[model samples]
Target: MAIAGASAQSQTYVLDKGWEFSQAGSNEWMSARVPGTVHQDLLDHGRLPDPFYGMNELKVQWVEKEDWLYRTVFTVTADQLKSDAAWLTFEGLDTYADVYLNGSLLLKADNMFVGHKLAVKDVLREGENRLMIRFRSPVEETAPQWDTDGFNYPADNDHSEKRMSVYTRKAPYSYGWDWGIRLATSGIWRPVKLTFCNGAAIDDFFVRQQEVTEQVAKVDNQLEINNVISTPKEAQVKVVYAYGEQADTLTRTVVLQPGKNSLSMPAWIEKPHLWMPNGWGDPVLYTFTATVSVDGKEVASREEAIGLRSIRVVMEDDKDGKSFYFEVNGKPMFAKGSNYIPGDALLPNMTGERYARLFEDIRAANMNMVRVWGGGIYEDDRFYEEADRNGILVWQDFIFACTTYPHDPTFLKRVSEEAVYNMRRLRNHASLAMWCGNNEIYEGMRYWGWKDKYSPVVWKEMTEGYDVLFRQLLPELVAANDPGRFYMHGSPYEANWGRPESWKIADSHNWGTWYGQKPFESLDTEIPRFMSEYGFQAFPEMKTIRMFASPEDYELESPVMNAHQKASIGNFLIKKTMALYYKVPEKFEDLIYAGLILQGQGMRHGIEAHRRHRPYCMGSLPWQLNDSWPVVSWSSIDYYGNWKAMHYQIRRAFAPVLVD
Candidate 1:
């Protein structure tokens, strides 16, 4: 549905066609897919083997070491080129890139997590224009930075030889994680767009829910308008709030300055319906349309949907330690869910349909929350939208995990920009619970023996860097941008899973059951204020395994099986624990079934134990809920979206009222 008031506001073109890519310095090019990667493009053109298949992952390791280039030709109208303001925007670029417009150097982008836009009116022409992007190999581009630092940051998850992921702003999992495949790929991983406007444009439009209740709801319709012209212009901003069979209108007329002008219009609605979480009430949403008109001619417009609700994290001190829980609408709520990794190693493969199915599975399994684990890309907008519609809360982590980063001014500035951009993009979502700094980074600083690996001077500098990044920079950014939302320095913030006293306080990631070889029964007794992470490994169902392995490759020690098991201790621990629970089965498929049962029973015990404690233990989010590959690891759902036996058991364990 188009906005009723939209007219000559702006003319935009999606530059997604006529794209091609080649190895840097090579004339041979292949038709490329935007919002894609070099690896996927290579495989699609039959130049490379399927990396996810058995042992073929080893064959495509050369792609990440070579730089790549992508180019496209787009046409623009004479009127568009004559506009007072014209801009080119790339919604995402894979790590290091240099963008050019019509052969003129335009911008250098270093972060994959944020969009980059530049004023290209002077560079763009009326006829055909060439746009090019050069994506430098992430490993090669960051190697010099690592060398200059003179000391290595401990990036255990990076499977690459140099471990330079800490020096790059790309998804850390692309370097490799315990559960993800190593594919440090590069390309134009998102859309490229061009826009033309005359007076001003809507930079951001948010319906800030100031106060909400059954009686009345107060809101401030905030608009950030960017004036592209040289002088002040008079503009009328009109906003219409619409719900089922109801609508309210608010209008403001103001003189916009040469640059960004912040404006807000306060309004109220009587008898407003509140947005509630899963198993609570309905998650009602209302839409708002805002239009900007200059001299009675509409210039820009935006439409957004928001939910009215209030949420806070309650952490008052209790007898054992500080209580950690989320308070929604003045009621303390228990979060029952699991950690979430990326749905696919190749991000573009995760489409809207995939996200819908994933959330549907989450709703069907009775999950109320999902921690978007750090290490993965900040998911597509479709993900959070689904969460809002399904009444599932989201725990978002800043994309830094399992490693320390440089605190140089240049590095910090990039991180700050990344933080602000993502915060602004996601702030209005009702499903967003809080912003966590990173995953396990704080714990790594305290308990991972990082200090022993460096001199006292180096250790002091590293520790101070951590404090600056997590304690000061990230929290300050959160306060400035999304003040109404909560921010945690990191997950398992005040607790270490290895320490006995840690369990009585804050959140905990109890790896003892799997990493420490502790029995499944230990989860029953070693409960915490919040069991944020704990799980046992399991193979995907036999059907999923058969997709990647041949009949002869079904054995645990086969080469094909080893290629799929990314975790160092994955196969060993599964076999070790299997012998303890049941007789080691001779049939390979039978053993796969047994592994699923073993994981299900272990997770069920932990989930039930956490729920049995009720108000004392407020959350139980297991190690993972889904997989990025068909492998033997800790995920209830596999990469093909097949539910392992553990998912069925988790569905039962997460019931609102579970007996025994």
Candidate 2:
């Protein structure tokens, strides 16, 4: 929400409306919406059928393969053009994008996970300015040239057999998921703004509570500023720290450099109040005003809230092989939650209210933690903000998933930049617990027969990328930037990975039910220390299923049903899973209801089983929390935020107290 701004010194104008979008190599443009994807824009103009509808997503397979272009015209007043620090900021551009201002090339963007800006003061005209953005095809752009013979282990992860997601810094889910369409979309997927700045502007507002305790805590603040003026200027860095009624101010005077300067300052609080995650105590937060003033005139002001809590990881090898858990304020916590993927594939369409509702449901269910899965987009600020307010700890993952990646120097450089940019932004949130390198890439490589099948050359390249990206690049960035959080190489990782299930020292994703098609009893046989991902699939409620399928064709194995259930053997898998516990119902609606309850029963039993092994199994975050579309997936909550029977079961399983 606070990326770019404008005033008399700097003024920001919204450029989110009144745009034209056209397929690349086209002569005509159609009315488009900014902060939207090409798929959404086409849907708005009625050229494309609803992808969420049954049998429609399969029909619209060409959307992800072609390129797209967006053009718009904005006006700038003569009075506003007096300042020299004018810029155009794109908060997000999905995958590859090229921008031109009045036919003059301005910027080329690669990563959809990050944002970029260009100084437009020189090229922008006074009366009217024409802006154009051309988005390249993600598939053609991200195709890897490396040898692919032995890397064919996880064969089901292909985005319609392209298998190009690993090479790009975009949302991996866009390529494909069991529940998602392969709409590897293009266009501006976030807010677009044009800002005009005169002299100085604040770039990054970073605030963190460091070395926190009950007696004293240090509040660290950093303000990165860019001074456009050619001369030196004196500025005041002031922080009004407030906790409850009492307030204090710490101010400093410094001479700013001509271009870029960072001012770091710290303040100590006496009798500090520590913040706590859910079920521990009230999550108390202190507010601070980060401001930059020149000669008593406030140029920039940012309000930030911080919770003073010291988080420690107590991981050690004990008689139980090893132990892993998070200690908040010196008290051990058993994390209770699920994995969070993108709420929707069209991210910009997900509003603050929708984001809040998801977390609200989590809070109501007594959930205290959520692992932002590695395959999805780095959830926007609204998601983390809601987590902070709800006292839900976040287990963040770097954007890598079930496949091995190449260790190309250029690709590594792009990844490093993305890491630096995103980590710096995520570090300030009080709810952030740990940085996981990936979801299941490491475990997949070990368990999916990659070690046996991989050629020596492919193995070498894969290991090089793993070491450099996770061990070297990410850890170094975290150490230099945010040392307060712990870094796990990956979930299900053990120091001695030779024995996958023996070293109960880390998190585990037991897919016995879905992938292995094992019975629910398998969850109890070899219990994980921390079950990060284990789930069963179920179709959504009839209200949602009917949106994609017609009532006349409402059979279980109907073409419409198969179209919605994208996972290989998904419908049959659910039928087999249901047959294990209850009689497979005759009617479609009865079958769906039975499947929902069966899935919930399985998950509820797993949660109780994990909790029964209290000290050994410290946490249980199931496979998924919500779905990206109206599909038969492993989400308790469907795309419309409707709670299935599993959502209610989670409320009981994750309750603060349990009774027989």
What ranges in model 2 sit over 4 Å off?
A: 1-8, 144-155, 495-500
lDDT per residue as tens, model 1, 236-271: 999998889899899888999999999989999998
- Please write out the lDDT profile of model 2 over residues 419-473, one tens digit for every residue: 8788887787889988888767777666677766677876777777788877788
lDDT of 1: 0.87
Q: What TM-score should be assigned to candidate 2?
A: 0.95
Against the true structure, candidate 2 has what lDDT?
0.81
Candidate 1: residue 422 lDDT (0-100): 88
Please name the candidate that would achieve the greatest lDDT relative to the true structure: 1
True lDDT of residue 309, candidate 1 = 82
Q: Extract clashing residue pairs from model 2.
A: 6-10, 6-11, 6-12, 7-10, 7-11, 54-548
